[model samples]
Target: MLIDIKGVLNLWGSFVRFTDCKGYPTMQAFMRESPQEREKQRYLPRLDDDTLAKVDRQIRKLDPAGKAKAYLANLAKPNDKREELESLESDELQFAILYLRYVAGLENKPIWQKLSLSKGAFENELRLAERFVEGVLIGSEIRLFL
Candidate 1:
């Protein structure tokens, strides 16, 4: 089957959100919402074991800091690349790491709250982060399992 890159990324985003929010009462209530309401939310796809293993390996090859720096560099045009790189916090990697962690069923509340992002904003960030990682992998000629 041809892979739906955007759909897979979106599903990963939802998986992150679900893992992050699952422990909270709010999330529980949301889950308990009517089937129609639940259906409105995005659902994660179930990949085969081999595909999942390959995806996980590809994901592990990512350098979070490098990815974050590249992402920031793209956003700032005609800027001092060295200065920008020097100023980057290791935490900047959290943008991608948090999403990956969420997919792994891990949650980091501090990072999630620190951004103070609305659901839509957070999802957008996750999408960008995923794109960055994908670009890095492809640029390096690494095959994406997804």
Candidate 2:
């Protein structure tokens, strides 16, 4: 087929702009990532078993009982913020605190300090609390925002 440079190419035929039917960017001109997003990706923390379960025994004990039944029973008055925290078990409450801290834009070290937990303990409880919360949410048929 004879190629027509007139319509297919722009800017002195230097680039085709897009590679395919998808209108994905092929332009050298790129969009700038928002500061919030760039910062999010950079500091995204990774968790490993050693960090979460420092004790071998705790690793085994850290099983989350996935009982979706009797869900929101954990907090009878879900709207009552203080009561909700009071209703949660220590581990769950700790995780909740960490989440609240994150929302407040606190970094890892400071957030851990606010919870009065060392790094390993914080990560460990966070995992367990996560599981418990999952069960409760599933039982209540409430979806997590994530």
Candidate 3:
């Protein structure tokens, strides 16, 4: 079966939201801000103590990591694709997942710098990793043909 690229990208976005490590609201907030604004906000750090406590309480209630793992397991199903994802080289998988996760507002320069990847190389690797993830989702038969 042929997979729709736009559908996959949309699914990938939703998957990233589902697996959000930083809490969904926080991720959404970050997504809403521009990169420069995010950087400024990071430096300025504007949450009040009560708000911070409330956020902490919400985080404790949410258990995002457990929820994300459960969701990923369900998505992977019989294929054990989550295991395959985990088995990828640390940089490759981390970059791919993070790239997808922060698709809304993340800047590539910082990530490439952190990963010690040249711009062109990082882009190439990220593309390949995304393709791999798409294959994993579509299944072994499709992946083998690819």
> What are the lDDT figures for the candidates, one per model?
0.47, 0.35, 0.42
> Which digits, one per residue and each the tens of the lDDT, describe model 2 over residues 87-131?
345644444443333323355576556555698876676556445
Order of quality (TM-score) = 3, 1, 2
> What TM-score would each prediction reach against the true structure?
0.34, 0.32, 0.37
Q: Whose TM-score is higher: candidate 2's or candidate 3's?
A: 3
Q: Looking at candidate 2, what is the lDDT of residue 134? A: 42
Backbone clashes in model 3: 0
Whichever of 1 and 3 has more TM-score, that candidate is 3
Write one digit per residue (lDDT tens) for candidate 1, span 11-66.
45554354334342445654654332222331334443333344444554544336
The 10-residue segment of model 3 with minimum total lDDT is 36-45
Model 1 regions lying over 4 Å from their true place = 1-3, 9-47, 63-111, 114-125, 136-146
lDDT of 3 at 14: 41
Winner by TM-score:
3
**lDDT string, candidate 3, 7-77, tens digits:** 44443344345445453243465466433211211111233333223332332222334443343344447
Residue 83 Cα positional deviation in candidate 2, in Å, after optimal superposition:
20
Looking at model 3, residue 28 earns an lDDT score of 66
Provide the lDDT at 91 for model 2. 49
| Candidate 2, RMSD to the unseen true structure | 21.4
